[model samples]
Target: MLNQTPLWKYIMVLMVVAVCTLYASPNLYGEDYAVQISAAKDSTVDLNLVDRVNAQLEKAGIETKAVALENEQILIRLNDDSSQRLAREALESALGRDYIVAMNLAPDTPEWLDNLGGTPMKLGLDLRGGVHFLMEVDMQSVMTKSLKDMEGDFKTSLREERIRYRRVSIVNDVVQIQFRDQETLEKAEFFLKNRNADITIVEQGELTLVASMSETKLAEIRDYAVKQNITIMRNRVNQLGVAEPLIQRQGADRIVVQLPGIQDTARAKEILNATATLEFRMVDLDHDVRDAVNGRVPPGSELINDQQGVPQLLKQDIMLEGSHIIDANSGVDEYGMPKVSISLDSAGGSKMSLGTKGNIGKPMATVFIEYQATNEKNADGKIIFVPEREVVSVATIRAQLGSRFEITGLDSPKEARDLALLLRAGALIAPITIVEERTVGPSLGQENIDLGMQAIIWGFVLVLAFMLVYYKAFGVVANVALTANLVMIVGVMSMIPGATLTLPGMAGIVLTVGMAVDANVLIFERIREELRDSRSPQQAIHHGYDSAFSTILDANITTFIAALILFAVGTGPIKGFSITLMIGIVTSMFTAIILTRTIVNGVWGGKRLEKLWI
Candidate 1:
């Protein structure tokens, strides 16, 4: 009597449960491993870099159960404690030597039941408890790049015109000039205008003309950088594989990324605070800085520091910049000097060829190696560097002439390797640092789960009590179907690959509980109307379900459409809400219509029964 639902309806419920069980089962079957990374204050994690790290973990004989990159943090699940430690060691080595921030192991997690990718459902940050971070884009880096690009253009223009100018540089967002009187400045401005149309010349005085990059150009550059940052951020996230990571632009120069389920605070810091911009400059050994300070360096070149820390008066002309260096890697020289192997594009290759060819046998130090360092400064704000002996030579560059070059200046054994890893990975151009950090332990997650379960239980009780009070026996039947419907929804979700359960998703489920019984309520009400209109109970039952079917279809169709649209447009929790709601609707329709109809037919078959109260 209790199992009066139609055979088809029974089959549907059983099939759903079976499929869910299958999906919720883990594939590995042996052990669960996990690692955590937390972004610290004043640091921003690179989601892409984190992925490379996880890959390294896998290479070290450990497999990842889950990798969740959270807001200002990262968390990973592995096979077991030993595996986790191995993974953590690999991660720490990578982060400490390659990236530019401080990270720690945080605290050890107690033995969790090996549920890596299991169906008990891991809660996201908002649902469970974890660190949340809001990161701002590096506008300073953007501005610096813009200035450098403009300066590069200025140099090119001067060289093309063959006009000898005293000095041309960017200072405070405006191009300044110290030319041979006002005539040379005017001529240089005119030449630059042809090369760059967006510069506006405003006369500061007779001897100087303040040239500003056009407002339109500036706006265009800003917009482009913001969009570029979004793509870069997205790539990083995809690499990290943070379940349902949220990355979007907050404003023109700020981005907001939320990584749920992260628990290590310090490790998160290392991933975010790196500015992986690599550059190559030849040492200007043709002149001495003493001459410049004493006003006798040279007419065409400026004095600059070389790889040996000695000042050389080299030509001011940039043979090849970092942008031309397509790739860089860390490697060892024949004599064991740490060096970064650099690769150049066609243009860079030609320039490097010409520059290195003429200066062969003569001294040429690689200039501007600041981009290679991990941490730029010490605690006291002084710059940090690996000693001179560790620095690589131009011969290091020559070995990989056409291919990618390795910067062997990496002092620590692992440093060169990690640097090579980052460069080959096409690391981020802009510097991003986490301005904040925190961690959420699994215990806190368990507490949230308890509370969420309590809420769900309370909600069901209230819904059941109300239904029974109002509709009596009909309400009881509908309530049973409702309960079955909820089970089906959960079961179905567990079966879908990307379907995750979150707090908002729980809200969707609760809302669906109310919706699941609508068809039953409508059918029962129709049956009562038919009975009152002089129809027998048997006739009432048949007509009620038959008539309600059309209405049920129309109502569910609209709600289903809305859920689909929500799924299409929404992100993160919103998408989770839509998915759960959609699945519930489908399950509710099956239970309420076919199950209720079958039960009613079984109860009052071929008889005009009275007294419907239970």
Candidate 2:
């Protein structure tokens, strides 16, 4: 009775280990090098598309293992990396822009295991080889835009308050307002200072009020811009079909993005580097477009060209931004032409209502704006990104509009669909330029996996050997628990959707093996001490486990807290390592204390012995 474990508890422990083992089995089957073919906006994937792909691959003399349609897409399994590359190139060339033929890794897990919701833990970029991008938020652009917005707000506020000002402009990064006289300027300064505490207002000359944001306010803007861009980048990355992409803030103004399963760096860049947004503004009906084109651009008006190269004068004031769009769907309208139905958030809806309530029968143009990075650098050694604006759609407001609207001037369904996708993904707050980019091939990822696996295997084997020789009978029990701990780690990682296995995470597993045995070491030493004090084998074993548990629990809880901190503050690989370390801590605790004790009691408990093997 001293060392015996309850029969029901023993069965429960076995059941847990068995379930973990079942989930862990999928990782062993590995993955296949394949290409995924899916439909684009104006294309469809069917048997005919598959036939065309087969013909192209055959013509190119590329060998493929199999081509099958699954999940509304076509998956072509290839022999190795070479064939995967060739197959993708051939398919892309044959399919043209209509279909998307991207590199994909198909899981080779058995159908039965897959049906039971068993999946391998996803690999990180470092372990799986993909594209990595280091993007820097354009803080200069952020400050400029913030000041521009502030200038607009100030003008609007002054007009609403009936404060007279001759002109309000931004010069040398400072917003300067020339008032009619000192009384108005003084009133404006006092009103602005009280209304916008973050904005610093100063008297410039006799009748001018100069305003600029305080340092703290500027810093807040920069932080928000970076954070917002990171959020938008995450939305864009989802559209790229990446499984485990890492997008995290790096330093103060830069972001690091790692796509673990993507091999196409060009496609990723095309989506992430450019910031595309929509601006809704009233068409300048009162201004002559020809006059504005002749170097006479009106105040608060801009001359923007449409897609057909027609110069159109539009109001500079923005009614709504694309960032407020909550949803968009592409379809045909009454004339069977392409259109996009849009839905806005509550604030956007209110703003839309305000902008359109009095502007009925007036045309509102949707300007598609994109910031593209150029090869030239500015004085700050940062890449220059130029904005490209084009009026894509111009529709007259028939009635008061709220959250819902439709754009009908799109040239094709493809364009309509693309517009909808971008709107749904949300727009970047500020432009971001790719300062650095690198692509990791699957081969390199495989090499990393192989090396990481070797380290784990070697560390594990050494641990097993050391335990067996030093502790003898109890060492065998410890080794069994160690093995179970490793299995449970993999199983738990596989079961958790957010857990991704990286190169550094494997090192965590190696560390866990040692910690798993350390608990057993404490218990065995306690047992030896009891035996030396002339205690019976059964009593020694009982006191040994009971006494060591407290110390083990204390050590593990502290270590678990440390791991949590690392996970909370760390990024990328550090996060991956911390995650595995945390999982390993929990599994090791169960195996070393409860599991190993259960095993030890069942093997050597309730024995009458004078001496102990441990």
Candidate that scores best on TM-score:
2
* Model 2 TM-score relative to the real fold: 0.82
Which pairs of residues collide in model 2? none
Q: What TM-score would each prediction reach against the true structure?
A: 0.58, 0.82
Off by over 4 Å in 1: 1-21, 24-33, 36-122, 157-167, 176-211, 215-242, 278-429, 438-444, 461-481, 491-500, 531-546, 549-583, 586-614
Provide C-alpha RMSD values for all models, in order. 10.0, 4.7
| RMSD versus native structure for model 2 | 4.7
- The weakest ten consecutive residues by lDDT in model 1 span 101-110
List per-prediction Cα lDDT, in the order shown. Answer: 0.61, 0.86
C-alpha positional error of residue 380 in candidate 1 after TM-score superposition, expressed in Å = 16
Instruction: Write down the lDDT that model 2 would get.
Output: 0.86
lDDT of 1 by residue, 1-614 (tens): 22235677657656755555444443223223355564422234668867776678767877765665654457666655576656666777766643322222222222342233344343466664555555555555567677776666565556556777766678788876566777777787687667567778665755665677788987877776666556556545433335555566666766666665544444443343333443344554555667676878777666554334555555555555544655666657898876666676786675566555545444343433322234676564433433221112333233324334444444554545544544444434355545445555657766766676787788889988888999898888888788777767766775566677777788888888888766778888898898888876667777888899899999999999999999998877788789889988888898898766666656655454665553
